[model samples]
Target: MVQNSTDPVGWEHFDHDADVGVRGIGVTQAQAFEQAALALTSIVTQIESVEPRQRIDISAENGDPELLFVDWLDALIFEMATRRMLFSRYKVDIEGERLSARAWGEPVDVNRHQPAVEIKGATLTELKVEEQDEGQWLAQCVVDV
Candidate 1:
Protein backbone atom coordinates (compact mmCIF):
# COMPACT_ATOMS: atom_id res chain seq x y z
CA MET A 1 0.00 0.00 0.00
CA VAL A 2 1.15 3.55 -0.70
CA GLN A 3 1.80 5.96 2.13
CA ASN A 4 -0.53 8.90 2.76
CA SER A 5 1.92 11.50 1.53
CA THR A 6 1.05 14.51 -0.61
CA ASP A 7 3.86 13.91 -3.08
CA PRO A 8 3.22 11.79 -6.14
CA VAL A 9 6.56 10.06 -5.59
CA GLY A 10 6.61 8.33 -2.25
CA TRP A 11 7.51 5.26 -0.20
CA GLU A 12 5.62 2.79 1.98
CA HIS A 13 6.20 -0.11 4.35
CA PHE A 14 4.38 -3.41 4.44
CA ASP A 15 4.21 -6.44 6.70
CA HIS A 16 6.55 -9.37 6.10
CA ASP A 17 6.50 -11.65 9.10
CA ALA A 18 9.55 -10.89 11.24
CA ASP A 19 11.09 -8.60 8.62
CA VAL A 20 9.65 -5.53 6.91
CA GLY A 21 8.93 -4.71 3.31
CA VAL A 22 9.85 -1.38 1.77
CA ARG A 23 8.22 -0.11 -1.41
CA GLY A 24 8.87 2.87 -3.62
CA ILE A 25 6.63 4.30 -6.34
CA GLY A 26 7.40 7.05 -8.82
CA VAL A 27 7.21 8.17 -12.44
CA THR A 28 10.71 6.91 -13.17
CA GLN A 29 12.83 3.98 -12.10
CA ALA A 30 15.47 6.24 -10.58
CA GLN A 31 12.88 8.07 -8.54
CA ALA A 32 11.44 4.82 -7.30
CA PHE A 33 14.88 3.68 -6.25
CA GLU A 34 15.40 6.92 -4.38
CA GLN A 35 12.10 6.61 -2.55
CA ALA A 36 12.86 3.00 -1.69
CA ALA A 37 16.07 4.13 -0.05
CA LEU A 38 14.07 6.61 2.00
CA ALA A 39 11.77 3.82 3.07
CA LEU A 40 14.81 1.84 4.17
CA THR A 41 16.02 4.79 6.20
CA SER A 42 12.62 5.23 7.79
CA ILE A 43 12.98 1.68 9.14
CA VAL A 44 15.81 2.91 11.33
CA THR A 45 14.61 6.34 12.42
CA GLN A 46 12.30 9.21 11.62
CA ILE A 47 13.55 10.37 8.23
CA GLU A 48 12.77 14.06 8.84
CA SER A 49 15.10 14.10 11.84
CA VAL A 50 18.09 13.04 9.77
CA GLU A 51 19.75 16.12 8.38
CA PRO A 52 21.61 15.95 5.07
CA ARG A 53 24.94 16.96 6.50
CA GLN A 54 27.18 14.51 4.62
CA ARG A 55 27.07 12.74 1.29
CA ILE A 56 28.04 9.20 0.36
CA ASP A 57 28.43 7.77 -3.13
CA ILE A 58 27.24 4.26 -3.93
CA SER A 59 27.11 2.09 -7.03
CA ALA A 60 25.91 -1.39 -7.94
CA GLU A 61 25.44 -3.55 -11.02
CA ASN A 62 23.54 -6.66 -12.04
CA GLY A 63 22.10 -8.09 -15.24
CA ASP A 64 18.67 -8.37 -13.68
CA PRO A 65 16.79 -5.36 -12.37
CA GLU A 66 15.48 -7.28 -9.40
CA LEU A 67 18.92 -8.33 -8.33
CA LEU A 68 20.15 -4.80 -8.89
CA PHE A 69 17.48 -3.54 -6.54
CA VAL A 70 18.67 -5.94 -3.87
CA ASP A 71 22.24 -4.90 -4.44
CA TRP A 72 21.22 -1.27 -4.10
CA LEU A 73 19.52 -1.77 -0.78
CA ASP A 74 22.31 -3.96 0.54
CA ALA A 75 24.79 -1.26 -0.37
CA LEU A 76 22.81 1.29 1.60
CA ILE A 77 22.52 -1.03 4.54
CA PHE A 78 26.23 -1.58 4.50
CA GLU A 79 26.84 2.15 4.49
CA MET A 80 24.49 2.76 7.36
CA ALA A 81 26.00 0.01 9.48
CA THR A 82 29.60 0.94 8.78
CA ARG A 83 29.30 4.70 8.99
CA ARG A 84 26.83 4.80 11.84
CA MET A 85 24.69 7.20 9.82
CA LEU A 86 21.14 7.59 8.59
CA PHE A 87 20.36 9.05 5.21
CA SER A 88 17.46 11.40 4.59
CA ARG A 89 18.07 12.22 0.92
CA TYR A 90 19.08 10.22 -2.12
CA LYS A 91 19.80 10.90 -5.79
CA VAL A 92 19.71 7.77 -7.94
CA ASP A 93 20.74 7.30 -11.55
CA ILE A 94 19.98 4.06 -13.32
CA GLU A 95 21.17 2.94 -16.71
CA GLY A 96 20.47 -0.60 -17.75
CA GLU A 97 21.27 -2.82 -14.75
CA ARG A 98 23.87 -0.41 -13.37
CA LEU A 99 22.99 2.06 -10.64
CA SER A 100 24.93 4.99 -9.21
CA ALA A 101 23.71 7.28 -6.50
CA ARG A 102 24.56 9.73 -3.75
CA ALA A 103 22.98 9.56 -0.31
CA TRP A 104 22.98 12.55 2.03
CA GLY A 105 22.54 12.57 5.80
CA GLU A 106 24.25 12.95 9.11
CA PRO A 107 25.67 10.57 11.67
CA VAL A 108 23.14 9.00 13.98
CA ASP A 109 22.12 11.06 16.98
CA VAL A 110 20.49 8.73 19.48
CA ASN A 111 18.81 11.48 21.52
CA ARG A 112 17.59 13.53 18.57
CA HIS A 113 16.75 10.63 16.25
CA GLN A 114 15.74 7.60 18.20
CA PRO A 115 16.40 4.49 16.17
CA ALA A 116 13.87 1.70 16.19
CA VAL A 117 15.66 -1.23 14.60
CA GLU A 118 18.90 -2.33 12.96
CA ILE A 119 18.39 -3.68 9.48
CA LYS A 120 20.64 -6.65 8.85
CA GLY A 121 20.14 -6.84 5.09
CA ALA A 122 17.74 -6.79 2.19
CA THR A 123 16.22 -10.11 1.25
CA LEU A 124 14.85 -11.58 -1.97
CA THR A 125 11.44 -12.12 -0.40
CA GLU A 126 8.78 -10.34 -2.44
CA LEU A 127 11.57 -8.76 -4.44
CA LYS A 128 10.29 -6.74 -7.36
CA VAL A 129 11.23 -3.99 -9.79
CA GLU A 130 8.78 -3.17 -12.51
CA GLU A 131 6.85 -0.44 -14.23
CA GLN A 132 3.19 -0.55 -13.35
CA ASP A 133 0.25 0.64 -15.40
CA GLU A 134 -0.13 4.41 -15.86
CA GLY A 135 3.63 4.78 -16.20
CA GLN A 136 4.46 4.35 -12.56
CA TRP A 137 7.58 2.42 -11.60
CA LEU A 138 7.89 0.36 -8.42
CA ALA A 139 10.83 -1.08 -6.53
CA GLN A 140 10.42 -3.15 -3.41
CA CYS A 141 11.85 -5.93 -1.23
CA VAL A 142 11.69 -7.34 2.25
CA VAL A 143 14.42 -6.24 4.63
CA ASP A 144 15.79 -8.32 7.48
CA VAL A 145 15.89 -6.38 10.72
Candidate 2:
Protein backbone atom coordinates (compact mmCIF):
# COMPACT_ATOMS: atom_id res chain seq x y z
CA MET A 1 0.00 0.00 0.00
CA VAL A 2 1.06 3.64 -0.62
CA GLN A 3 0.44 6.77 1.38
CA ASN A 4 0.62 10.48 0.72
CA SER A 5 1.72 13.32 2.96
CA THR A 6 1.03 16.51 0.98
CA ASP A 7 2.33 16.01 -2.52
CA PRO A 8 -0.10 15.79 -5.44
CA VAL A 9 2.17 13.10 -6.96
CA GLY A 10 5.00 11.16 -5.37
CA TRP A 11 6.56 7.79 -4.52
CA GLU A 12 7.31 5.90 -1.31
CA HIS A 13 8.51 2.50 -0.13
CA PHE A 14 7.83 0.05 2.64
CA ASP A 15 10.02 0.08 5.70
CA HIS A 16 13.08 -2.20 6.03
CA ASP A 17 13.31 -2.28 2.22
CA ALA A 18 13.53 1.52 1.94
CA ASP A 19 15.36 2.80 -1.14
CA VAL A 20 15.72 -0.73 -2.41
CA GLY A 21 11.99 -0.53 -3.16
CA VAL A 22 9.63 2.34 -4.06
CA ARG A 23 5.97 2.99 -4.98
CA GLY A 24 4.45 5.80 -7.06
CA ILE A 25 0.95 7.15 -7.79
CA GLY A 26 -1.07 9.62 -9.93
CA VAL A 27 -4.69 10.40 -10.89
CA THR A 28 -4.00 8.77 -14.25
CA GLN A 29 -1.24 6.76 -15.88
CA ALA A 30 -0.15 9.81 -17.80
CA GLN A 31 -0.39 11.82 -14.62
CA ALA A 32 1.34 9.04 -12.75
CA PHE A 33 4.06 9.11 -15.36
CA GLU A 34 4.37 12.83 -14.81
CA GLN A 35 4.41 12.37 -11.05
CA ALA A 36 6.99 9.65 -11.39
CA ALA A 37 9.05 12.15 -13.36
CA LEU A 38 8.42 14.69 -10.63
CA ALA A 39 9.57 12.21 -8.03
CA LEU A 40 12.66 11.69 -10.12
CA THR A 41 13.01 15.43 -10.39
CA SER A 42 12.60 15.68 -6.64
CA ILE A 43 15.40 13.18 -6.30
CA VAL A 44 17.54 15.29 -8.63
CA THR A 45 16.49 18.84 -7.74
CA GLN A 46 14.08 21.18 -6.00
CA ILE A 47 11.63 20.42 -8.89
CA GLU A 48 9.56 23.56 -8.37
CA SER A 49 12.24 25.59 -10.09
CA VAL A 50 13.05 23.16 -12.86
CA GLU A 51 11.60 24.92 -15.89
CA PRO A 52 9.93 22.69 -18.49
CA ARG A 53 10.47 24.53 -21.77
CA GLN A 54 11.46 21.83 -24.23
CA ARG A 55 9.52 18.95 -25.75
CA ILE A 56 10.31 15.59 -27.31
CA ASP A 57 8.26 12.81 -28.87
CA ILE A 58 8.86 9.30 -27.52
CA SER A 59 7.06 6.08 -28.35
CA ALA A 60 7.68 2.64 -26.88
CA GLU A 61 5.77 -0.62 -26.61
CA ASN A 62 5.97 -3.67 -24.33
CA GLY A 63 3.77 -6.64 -23.52
CA ASP A 64 3.98 -6.09 -19.79
CA PRO A 65 2.40 -2.91 -18.52
CA GLU A 66 4.47 -2.95 -15.35
CA LEU A 67 7.72 -3.24 -17.21
CA LEU A 68 6.49 -0.72 -19.71
CA PHE A 69 5.92 1.81 -16.95
CA VAL A 70 9.39 1.31 -15.57
CA ASP A 71 10.94 1.52 -19.01
CA TRP A 72 9.11 4.75 -19.78
CA LEU A 73 10.30 6.46 -16.64
CA ASP A 74 13.81 5.11 -17.14
CA ALA A 75 14.04 6.61 -20.61
CA LEU A 76 13.05 10.03 -19.29
CA ILE A 77 15.45 9.83 -16.38
CA PHE A 78 18.23 8.72 -18.65
CA GLU A 79 17.63 11.70 -20.89
CA MET A 80 17.63 14.07 -17.94
CA ALA A 81 20.73 12.65 -16.31
CA THR A 82 22.67 12.21 -19.50
CA ARG A 83 21.34 15.17 -21.43
CA ARG A 84 20.74 17.39 -18.41
CA MET A 85 17.25 18.59 -19.38
CA LEU A 86 14.02 19.56 -17.62
CA PHE A 87 10.52 19.19 -19.02
CA SER A 88 7.25 20.71 -17.86
CA ARG A 89 4.65 19.22 -20.16
CA TYR A 90 3.68 15.69 -21.23
CA LYS A 91 1.17 14.32 -23.74
CA VAL A 92 0.59 10.57 -23.73
CA ASP A 93 -1.49 8.56 -26.18
CA ILE A 94 -2.17 5.12 -24.72
CA GLU A 95 -3.86 2.33 -26.62
CA GLY A 96 -4.22 -1.29 -25.57
CA GLU A 97 -1.80 -0.54 -22.76
CA ARG A 98 0.93 0.79 -25.03
CA LEU A 99 2.08 4.40 -24.88
CA SER A 100 3.12 6.95 -27.47
CA ALA A 101 3.95 10.07 -25.58
CA ARG A 102 5.58 13.47 -25.93
CA ALA A 103 7.56 15.26 -23.27
CA TRP A 104 8.33 18.99 -23.24
CA GLY A 105 11.19 20.70 -21.47
CA GLU A 106 14.58 22.32 -21.80
CA PRO A 107 18.15 21.69 -20.74
CA VAL A 108 18.94 21.86 -17.08
CA ASP A 109 21.42 24.41 -15.86
CA VAL A 110 23.41 24.61 -12.64
CA ASN A 111 21.46 27.75 -11.82
CA ARG A 112 17.95 26.59 -12.86
CA HIS A 113 17.74 22.82 -13.03
CA GLN A 114 19.93 21.83 -10.10
CA PRO A 115 19.08 18.24 -9.35
CA ALA A 116 18.13 17.30 -5.81
CA VAL A 117 19.01 13.61 -5.79
CA GLU A 118 20.71 11.12 -8.03
CA ILE A 119 18.14 8.67 -9.34
CA LYS A 120 20.18 5.59 -10.11
CA GLY A 121 17.40 3.79 -12.00
CA ALA A 122 13.89 2.40 -12.00
CA THR A 123 12.96 -0.83 -10.22
CA LEU A 124 10.38 -3.63 -10.59
CA THR A 125 9.20 -4.28 -7.05
CA GLU A 126 5.44 -4.01 -6.64
CA LEU A 127 4.82 -2.42 -10.03
CA LYS A 128 1.28 -2.17 -11.37
CA VAL A 129 -0.99 -0.53 -13.98
CA GLU A 130 -4.78 -0.41 -13.75
CA GLU A 131 -7.60 1.60 -15.25
CA GLN A 132 -10.43 2.78 -13.07
CA ASP A 133 -14.14 2.86 -13.96
CA GLU A 134 -14.00 6.62 -13.79
CA GLY A 135 -11.68 6.53 -16.83
CA GLN A 136 -8.36 7.24 -15.16
CA TRP A 137 -5.31 5.06 -15.66
CA LEU A 138 -3.11 4.47 -12.65
CA ALA A 139 0.44 3.19 -12.88
CA GLN A 140 2.64 2.34 -9.96
CA CYS A 141 6.36 1.89 -10.44
CA VAL A 142 9.24 1.48 -8.03
CA VAL A 143 12.11 3.59 -9.27
CA ASP A 144 15.67 3.34 -7.92
CA VAL A 145 15.97 7.08 -7.73
Candidate 3:
Protein backbone atom coordinates (compact mmCIF):
# COMPACT_ATOMS: atom_id res chain seq x y z
CA MET A 1 0.00 0.00 0.00
CA VAL A 2 1.06 3.61 -0.68
CA GLN A 3 0.03 6.09 1.97
CA ASN A 4 1.13 9.22 3.73
CA SER A 5 1.55 8.94 7.47
CA THR A 6 -1.00 11.68 8.07
CA ASP A 7 -3.38 10.91 5.21
CA PRO A 8 -6.24 8.48 5.19
CA VAL A 9 -6.13 8.04 1.41
CA GLY A 10 -4.04 5.20 0.07
CA TRP A 11 -3.60 2.63 -2.68
CA GLU A 12 -2.69 -1.04 -2.74
CA HIS A 13 -2.05 -4.02 -5.01
CA PHE A 14 -3.31 -7.56 -4.62
CA ASP A 15 -2.35 -10.95 -6.12
CA HIS A 16 -4.15 -11.89 -9.28
CA ASP A 17 -2.18 -14.71 -10.82
CA ALA A 18 -0.57 -13.41 -14.04
CA ASP A 19 -2.20 -10.03 -13.70
CA VAL A 20 -2.60 -7.70 -10.72
CA GLY A 21 -5.38 -6.09 -8.74
CA VAL A 22 -5.31 -2.35 -7.97
CA ARG A 23 -7.32 -0.87 -5.13
CA GLY A 24 -7.81 2.58 -3.62
CA ILE A 25 -9.39 3.83 -0.42
CA GLY A 26 -10.48 7.33 0.47
CA VAL A 27 -13.14 9.45 2.13
CA THR A 28 -14.76 10.30 -1.19
CA GLN A 29 -15.30 8.57 -4.51
CA ALA A 30 -13.19 11.09 -6.36
CA GLN A 31 -10.34 10.64 -3.94
CA ALA A 32 -10.65 6.88 -4.25
CA PHE A 33 -10.41 7.20 -8.03
CA GLU A 34 -7.29 9.31 -7.73
CA GLN A 35 -5.72 6.76 -5.41
CA ALA A 36 -6.61 3.99 -7.84
CA ALA A 37 -4.64 5.83 -10.51
CA LEU A 38 -1.73 5.97 -8.11
CA ALA A 39 -2.03 2.25 -7.63
CA LEU A 40 -1.87 1.84 -11.38
CA THR A 41 1.27 3.95 -11.60
CA SER A 42 2.88 2.08 -8.72
CA ILE A 43 2.53 -1.17 -10.63
CA VAL A 44 5.14 0.07 -13.08
CA THR A 45 7.37 2.37 -11.04
CA GLN A 46 7.81 3.90 -7.63
CA ILE A 47 5.34 6.79 -7.42
CA GLU A 48 7.85 8.93 -5.52
CA SER A 49 10.41 8.63 -8.33
CA VAL A 50 8.15 10.20 -10.92
CA GLU A 51 8.18 13.93 -11.54
CA PRO A 52 4.98 15.73 -12.44
CA ARG A 53 6.49 17.67 -15.29
CA GLN A 54 3.58 17.41 -17.70
CA ARG A 55 -0.14 17.43 -17.34
CA ILE A 56 -2.79 15.47 -19.27
CA ASP A 57 -6.54 15.78 -19.06
CA ILE A 58 -8.82 12.75 -19.23
CA SER A 59 -12.55 12.18 -19.28
CA ALA A 60 -14.85 9.16 -19.30
CA GLU A 61 -18.55 8.52 -18.86
CA ASN A 62 -20.63 5.51 -17.88
CA GLY A 63 -23.82 5.20 -15.91
CA ASP A 64 -22.37 2.40 -13.88
CA PRO A 65 -19.70 3.41 -11.38
CA GLU A 66 -17.79 0.14 -11.78
CA LEU A 67 -17.60 0.45 -15.55
CA LEU A 68 -16.67 4.10 -15.30
CA PHE A 69 -13.80 3.20 -12.98
CA VAL A 70 -12.51 0.71 -15.56
CA ASP A 71 -12.69 3.35 -18.28
CA TRP A 72 -10.68 5.76 -16.13
CA LEU A 73 -7.85 3.25 -15.64
CA ASP A 74 -7.90 2.11 -19.26
CA ALA A 75 -7.65 5.74 -20.33
CA LEU A 76 -4.58 6.17 -18.18
CA ILE A 77 -3.02 3.00 -19.59
CA PHE A 78 -3.66 4.24 -23.10
CA GLU A 79 -2.03 7.55 -22.32
CA MET A 80 1.00 5.82 -20.82
CA ALA A 81 1.51 3.61 -23.87
CA THR A 82 0.94 6.32 -26.45
CA ARG A 83 2.92 9.08 -24.75
CA ARG A 84 5.58 6.91 -23.15
CA MET A 85 4.80 8.58 -19.82
CA LEU A 86 4.14 7.57 -16.22
CA PHE A 87 1.80 9.67 -14.13
CA SER A 88 2.35 10.21 -10.43
CA ARG A 89 -0.35 12.76 -9.63
CA TYR A 90 -4.01 12.85 -10.43
CA LYS A 91 -7.12 14.96 -9.71
CA VAL A 92 -10.56 13.60 -10.47
CA ASP A 93 -14.07 15.04 -10.51
CA ILE A 94 -17.19 12.94 -10.77
CA GLU A 95 -20.65 14.26 -11.55
CA GLY A 96 -23.28 11.65 -12.06
CA GLU A 97 -22.06 9.23 -14.73
CA ARG A 98 -19.28 11.42 -16.02
CA LEU A 99 -15.70 11.63 -14.84
CA SER A 100 -13.20 14.36 -15.67
CA ALA A 101 -9.63 14.31 -14.45
CA ARG A 102 -6.10 15.53 -14.94
CA ALA A 103 -2.91 13.53 -14.55
CA TRP A 104 0.61 14.84 -14.13
CA GLY A 105 3.88 13.08 -14.92
CA GLU A 106 6.94 13.02 -17.11
CA PRO A 107 8.14 10.89 -20.00
CA VAL A 108 9.43 7.55 -18.84
CA ASP A 109 13.13 7.29 -18.11
CA VAL A 110 13.93 3.62 -18.08
CA ASN A 111 17.07 4.19 -16.07
CA ARG A 112 15.25 6.28 -13.51
CA HIS A 113 11.66 5.05 -13.45
CA GLN A 114 12.58 1.39 -13.78
CA PRO A 115 9.13 0.33 -14.78
CA ALA A 116 8.43 -3.24 -13.66
CA VAL A 117 5.66 -4.06 -16.16
CA GLU A 118 3.48 -2.63 -18.89
CA ILE A 119 -0.21 -2.60 -18.17
CA LYS A 120 -2.26 -3.57 -21.19
CA GLY A 121 -5.58 -2.46 -19.76
CA ALA A 122 -7.98 -2.58 -16.83
CA THR A 123 -10.35 -5.55 -16.68
CA LEU A 124 -13.72 -6.20 -15.12
CA THR A 125 -12.33 -8.97 -12.96
CA GLU A 126 -12.99 -8.05 -9.34
CA LEU A 127 -14.16 -4.63 -10.47
CA LYS A 128 -15.83 -2.60 -7.77
CA VAL A 129 -16.72 0.99 -6.73
CA GLU A 130 -18.49 1.27 -3.47
CA GLU A 131 -18.77 3.11 -0.18
CA GLN A 132 -17.52 0.64 2.39
CA ASP A 133 -18.30 2.76 5.44
CA GLU A 134 -20.16 5.91 6.37
CA GLY A 135 -17.32 8.04 5.06
CA GLN A 136 -15.02 5.68 3.25
CA TRP A 137 -15.03 4.74 -0.42
CA LEU A 138 -13.19 2.00 -2.29
CA ALA A 139 -12.38 1.52 -5.95
CA GLN A 140 -10.65 -1.50 -7.44
CA CYS A 141 -10.13 -3.75 -10.46
CA VAL A 142 -7.81 -6.29 -11.98
CA VAL A 143 -5.35 -5.00 -14.53
CA ASP A 144 -3.75 -6.83 -17.44
CA VAL A 145 -0.05 -6.45 -16.94
Best model number under lDDT = 3
Scored by TM-score, the top model is 3
Better of 2 and 3 by lDDT: 3
- Report lDDT (CA) for all predictions: 0.92, 0.65, 0.94
* Worst-scoring 10-residue span by lDDT in model 1: 1-10
- Model 3 backbone overlap count: 0
What lDDT tens digits, residue by residue, belong to model 3 across residues 73-96? 999999999999999999999999
Prediction RMSDs, each to the true structure: 1.5, 3.7, 1.5
Clashing pairs in 1: none
Q: What are the TM-scores, per candidate, against the unseen true structure?
A: 0.95, 0.73, 0.96
For candidate 2, the per-residue lDDT at 135 reads: 44
The C-alpha stretches of model 1 lying farther than 4 A from their native spots are 5-7
Which 10-residue window in model 2 sums to the lowest lDDT?
Answer: 13-22
- lDDT by residue (tens digit), candidate 1, 1-145: 4566655689999998899999998889889999999999999998999999999999999999999999999999999999999999999999987999999999999999999989999999999999985668899999999
**For candidate 2, what is the lDDT?**
0.65
Residue 83: error of model 1 in Å?
Answer: 0.5
